[model samples]
Target: MQARAAQDLKARMTDALVEAGLTYAGAVAHHTPRRLVLSVQGLLDQSPTLREERKGPRVDAPEKAVEGFLRGAGIDRSQLQERDDKKGRVYFAVIEHPGRPAAEIIAETLENVVRNFPWPKSMRWGAGSLKWVRPLHSILCILTADSGEAQVVPLDIDGIKAGDTTYGHRFMAPDGFAVTSYDDYTAKMRRARVMLDADERAGHIWQEAQNIAFSQGLEVVEDKGLLAEVAGLVEWPVTLMGEIDEEFLDLPPEVLQTSMKEHQKFFSVRNVQNGDSAGGIVRFITVANIETPDHGATILAGNQKVLSARLADAKFFWENDLRIVRDKGLTGMAEGLSDVTFHRKLGSQADRVARITALAREIAPMVGAKPDLAAEAAQICKADLQSEMVGEFPELQGVMGRYYAQAAGHDDGVPEACEMHYKPLGPGDTVPTEPVSVAVALADKIDTLTGFWAIDEKPTGSKDPYALRRAALGVIRLVLANGLRVELASTLVRPYHQNIRAALERHGAIPAEELNLPELSFDKVGLVERYQESKEGGTEDVPAVDDLLAFFHDRLKVHLRDEGIRHDVIDACLAMDGNDDLTLLVKRAEALAEFLKTDDGENLLQGFKRANNILTQAEEKDGVEYSFGADVKFAEVEEERALFDALKAADGAIKPAMEAEDFAAAMAAMAALRPAVDAFFEAVQVNAENPVVRRNRLNLLGQIRGICLAVADLTRVEG
Candidate 1:
């Protein structure tokens, strides 16, 4: 809490100072359980005086406008100077403001920081209407000069006035001390048995804990987060390691760790040789505020007694859960999920599991998994949610399920899936490598995205309560990492359509007279048949598969942006056929992205743009498209004849490469026509004097546009 307080204070104070126009060279903030401190170095004494001229109405404007301008600028007519304006001569009012001392700004900024500090939650004390993380214990406000003179800034808020004195640790040194500078204050704090720096205190705890644990041939579990939190709980940290009770040692190591950490703010000390076994961790460590007379032996005993009681409760929960696992297996443990509501709009956890199971079964063969194994894994992965162990320790949800699955005589792949299906929870997390885990994992995330999108609950702006973006990223990693050739749109279209129907029926979005489910179309742009007349003659409810596909494309763009693929490049590929096949779309995008980096590709793009622009204008003006064969005989110039031959040759190469989905080869073939295109543009006048030649040249430009677009829509590829 103190660390968080320190961080909050630093950011808030910095913002306040900057807002108050008091820029500084450097600033640092520190906190302990009792207080927060901030020090600024080389802060400007005052904001610089601002001076500028305010423009007014034109010199020849009406008298009313001149009066309003004088009033707005706070100037008399005599003070206005004539200046040339866009329309006519305008009056300019000279404006000047003087700077104030930094001390004055600091006082006001500090008061605002104190009264309006965002403490997450705060409270009022005495009769004052002020709230803080705690009571505004004491305020240490000072300004030290290079001449060794220190002055206290006048600040009083909510009965707490500014002072030069602050007390150290409440128990060790309760006396207050006056300080002339930040350096003097910190030196006194260290001597008074208080460490003002949170990192310093945390480092002391961790280093001492390791040294002591090493003395006993055991190692403390490294938890930097827990260390930081524990450091915040005390002013002067005294690290102590305690032994666990022999009776409670038989409990699961995770149960032991969770019980100690959650209930007592303790760290587990593990015997490395016996790792993962029940008795692997035989000791626990705790940080105390003050050093005891017996060198922490008494503190160790008291903490161990409390830890034993906590572990006893954990052991009871563990054994009871183990009995259920052995007798009924993971399947029986998860039966309670039917009664648990996953969402009010969606169905129960059991309902989601069924959907995932069915989806996994369908997706298994595509990802190289046996359908039966993938189906079984999905059924049992979430079983731990119903276990008593997980009920007490929710962080161990997937972890405990793995243990129970193993106990239920399931194969390694099934148990592995039980724990690994939630892999790659974020971008930094690892994607599961096992084929069954991959299949089940993809199914789980895809079902989440599809189910929520069906209900139109997709994330907007920054709000993603369902973590749909992470799920989409997880799906991307699962596909790309494994090189799976799955069509994400086809995979999403069917189940997503079903889910849309279910969600629509559940939400009552459709007309009550009768349900009219539209046919799904995967061979084209949309997943659902759109623009259908309602039974009563309006619009009907159908899956928003196209919108959802676009959403996935947006996510995929974000995922690939770091790889140097531009959004316009992805948009160009998305505009083409087979965009539903994400693997194919990305493959084409990656190839096109690389190709566009070359001189040949760049020139070809310019040529294609030239052809497209002319064709678009000509078609709109003539009210007819020039998308047909170009006759070489009609070409009056050698450049036009050479382009015709280049077009035919490029057509032969791009056709087979595109047919085979070899985008690189097709892009290369298309690029080879750049010289022919450049030569034609340089030599031939496209709008020739003769009508036949003009018509033939327009058709040739049309062929250039058509052939290049066949590779990837170059119209969307930005210059």
Candidate 2:
């Protein structure tokens, strides 16, 4: 995160400074909580004076256009000269800009950067029109030459003026002092209890936290994000360790940790003797701004006092929730979900839960989970969303459900399923391996994809408000990691039909107009009510199950794009059958991707494209397809006859290879045809004088297309 932010700051400040007329070799931007500092090196005393040629509109063009150009360039009719151009004679002007001192340029640039800083949010302070993210503070601008002589760059903004003096460590060393140069300023700040660099502060905070936890035989729960945030809050870092009361320790470790980190910006200390995070968290650590004579004891005590109150509330919620879970059961906790809308048209969370439960039950056997166990996991997986513990901490929604499920005396794996179903929240997140977890996880993601697809709420470009891309990738990783052989299109149809019916009942019509798929028989969708009896089945051909299936291919394409398999390769395989079975599709894509990188594959692709091009033009010109009945008798050249023999051999080898899903073997078979195809293209001409012979050669080319496509759809693979 800091890396990207630093890069953006460097680029923005560089461009802004250059535009403001400061000349330098380069500039680097460093960020801390209190400041964004740009250290520019190899700076000239002043920007180089520029002599530029400016142009005006054509001489015969509109008067207003020429006048506007002149006015914008700050030139007059006397300064303009006539020049010859393609359209006509045009007016040109020479402009001279005298350079200003680097200090003056820098001061002006800094003022503008501060005044109109591109913060996502800013505020006006003390009635000034200029806005800033924070209140006005001192500006310390300086310019130094190679000889080591330094001058304080003059700047004055909103009544605050630049000076050689800057204060440090708001509490510990708040007094201001003067300095001569960058080196002097940093050394002074360090001595005054301020760590000038954010990284240094972060290192000190983390090392101290770890040491404090280690002395107590526990480890600091590593939250890089929380560490970075807390590091920004102080300059003189004082890491303080505090204890959680024994009563609150009975609450889930996640609860205790999350409460401390979220509310108080403290890091949790965990006793992970078994090398699992599930090992309970035992204590907490917070930071102080300064050191005291009595050390951090007073600070730790005050922090614990505040932390205990927060944990007391959490304990109350946990106990009350466990009581609700035991008395009312998971279903009782989930009762409020029916009223909570998941989407306006897709019904409530209760409706979504019911759909997920159905899908999970159907998917359980395929993923090696017991149907009953998968069904039970899916039913109550989201029950904690209604719990007070989850209400207070939404980030722990699935996690708290696991605790509640265990407390309710459900099966051991059921609780794990509740927590792990949301596994792999992102690219770096882990995919769950347990069967019940896999079943519920797949069901949950698949339902989201199909439901949104049914409503035509598919992601467009970068705007995936639903994070359907992550959902699809999650499904892909889960299936591939577990080696599940589920066909996605057939799997998604039941839920798609359910969504269509639900939407129809709610809004009285199927949203066929919004879907960009095959034909949808919206008027006849009523027939889906008697799904078993419906002759055509409840599925629509338009925006058919195939369309949503296409969406998964796109998501899968994004997921595998960085794995060296090109988009065209994924697209080629997506064009084939069983593309809905992502594992098979990806395997084919990977093999084909590897093949295309080889000499044999490259030659084969060219040969195939050449054959396809000839065949396509012939069929279009003749208004007839010359499909695969190429006869060796009509082949007038050895090359054509050799291709005929190769096609037969390839056709024989490719079929069984594809049947076994051995794409590497199939591609090898196809690759053997490349020599014959290249020789044929070189020797044989498809548009022969004899119409019969011409038809035979075109058909031979068609055979090449057919053979190549048999491995994977090579037509979609670009040259």
Candidate 3:
């Protein structure tokens, strides 16, 4: 009975397998062994080891079917994967299934699983109920065995059944037939003149293009972006050389290059030996979409015609600009400046130029340039805004103005300054070493910074819309790189305060009279009073000029840190009053850093710290301040009297040394007192039995602190 039951099951399974299109071929001849071999090409009938049933309305989703088939196969979820949409069909993986063939089960599952499939965005078309990127198409499914025959997998999507064939490019290929293996499928596609791998085709195009350029003694400015884009646009790539019309060669090379790259996607080629020649012609490497019989002559001509029109427009703009320069003085070019907004809150370009001119006049003498020339340079710096060439290409801002100024017969320095003012625009950019250019450039940047600061638009964190941080760094590079002895605070503070006052007046935020302060010299006490009053009455939201000066000191530390200067050294130097002069501040910081590397300097700092700590502790504990002079008469011990004498000598030497800006000499003189300081601390007892002596000792420590701090804040030195 069991035998009969097994036979019945086997017959039913064999019938089902035959209906599913499985075939069996046995006793194939083995030529080498002279023997017959059994060949099987069909599903094995057995009780199902894994069973999963998915019930849904009629569906056609390949991905859904793939999921159910993998689940029913007891396959790991990690083994199943989905990839990007191909043409209009979604692709998915199906793992091994028991009882039924893997591909067959996947095909059957898809028909039932896709009825309730969801799509983020989908469309329905034609006379079918199925939805897809386009209408449903044929399914390609096959399961191959180690022997030879492919187990037929039946599937239908909108009445389209699974098959084992795929065609190549329609125009280049025509014949199509069944594919027994993936290798056979790829081989057939290749034989039909199709590149199955996109990267291989791209590599061929690049190598050929490079070879052609190298053979001609020219270089192809290979743009990877253009190459990738062109690769996508073509099934086959063929490189061709094209020539530019000589008439269009008069345009700037940058213009020619931009036109060719933007409009035609042509690679610009340069002659190998034309490095020093301005008249060298531009060779364009054209990438052709097809290998044409005429070698892409038609394509080249079409591209050249478009490029010629672009260059002609550039030439027209160039000529029109030269004519405008001849008709009007560069100053007269300000008529168009109204249209160019400098900043949303900072008025027009003309207005910015006016402010910069005012600043240049104030800053010129410090950089050793005549005020008149600096002011003139700043006035017309933005005048190129009126030029047609600059209007077309904004990058030619200062460059166009220089040409116009020279054409108008302005001073030689004026024209040069106009071009030089926007320099050091980036890290690799050259600084304006010329005195007039340096003065004007500093003025322009300072005006931008102060103007922005006045309007409360200072840079915070990484959000500098105005690029004030770059401007500030440019100012630092200009001053330090040129060895200019300009005071950043003196240059920035007055202009900054004035702009803030102006902005306040313009907005009716403050009374005009409230901002009016008497002009007093830096040495005058009235100057401090006037500046304090301005701080109190200036824009309520904006920080004071004093606060801005502090900000500059902070920026100076940041700037010097990269140059190997210590932050503590910068702090020590800046602690002195009137250290606002950046050049002097930097010199002092540098000198102090060099000095601190020495034994005397190191030991002196340690001594000074010890003295300071003791004095501070004494003052706090006694509830008494000791910021007074130490009388020589109160010195009882020999060491105390010796320290007093040393202090007098050192103070006299240091005063003259610092006045001469000989900070090293001043530090040297201070070092002379180290021994005396050590002796005094060793010999004398502070908080002694005698009140006057103890008070006197405390005052002596305070005096040493004061003298050392006068050179620099020694307390800032890290031991």
Best candidate (score: TM-score): 2
> Cα deviation of 330 in candidate 2 (Å)?
1.6
The predicted structure with the larger TM-score, 2 or 3, is 2
| After superposition, candidate 3 runs with Cα above 4 Å error | 1-244, 252-306, 343-345, 503-543, 623-652, 671-693
Full ranking by lDDT: 1, 2, 3
Q: Model 1 off-target regions past 4 Å?
A: 1-23, 44-102, 202-224, 246-250, 269-283, 499-514, 518-541, 633-638
Q: Write the per-residue lDDT of candidate 3 for residues 367-420, one digit (tens) a residue.
A: 888988888888888887777767666777787677778877878488888988
TM-score of 2: 0.89
Clashes of each: 1, 4, 1
Clashing pairs in 2: 517-543, 518-542, 518-543, 519-542
Pairs clashing in candidate 1? 45-102
Superposed Cα RMSD, model 2: 4.5
- RMSD (Cα, Å) for all candidates, in order, is 5.5, 4.5, 16.8
Q: lDDT per model, in order?
A: 0.83, 0.81, 0.69
Indicate whether candidate 1 or candidate 3 has the larger lDDT. Answer: 1
Clashing pairs in 3: 59-115
lDDT per residue, candidate 1, 1-719, as tens digits?
Answer: 56567777778877888876778889898888887888888888788888878888888889999999889988788888998878889889998778888778888888877787777788887898888867777888998988878889988887788988888878888998999998998999998999988889999999999999889778888888899899888889998888888998777787788888889999999886555422477899999999767999988888888887777778887788889988888889889999999877678999889878877877788888998999999999899999888888998888888888888889959988988899888877888989899989988998888778766788989999999889888888888888787767655554455544544574575444444554322223222222221223444444476777777788789988977799999899999987778788889999999999999998999999998999899899999999996899898878888999999999999999998989999999999999999999999889888878888899999999999999999999999
Tell me the lDDT of model 1 at 252.
70
**Which has the higher TM-score value, candidate number 1 or candidate number 2?**
2
Q: Could you tell me the lDDT of residue 152 within candidate 2?
A: 89
Tens digits of per-residue lDDT for model 2, 1-719: 34344556677666766776765687666556666566787777888788899877888889899889888989888888899988789899889898888888888777776776667667887866778667868777788778778798888887888887888878788899987767787789889888867888899999999888778778898999998898878878898887888877777888988999899999998886667656787888899988998899999999999999999999999989989998999989999999999988787999888878866876788888998899899999999999999899999989998988998888848999999998779888999999999999988998787777766788888899999888988988998888788777655554345445545444644654553222323234322332333324543343445666666677788788967679888889888888888889888988999899999999889888887888888888889988867789987988888988999999999999999989899989988988888888888778899999998888888888888877888889888
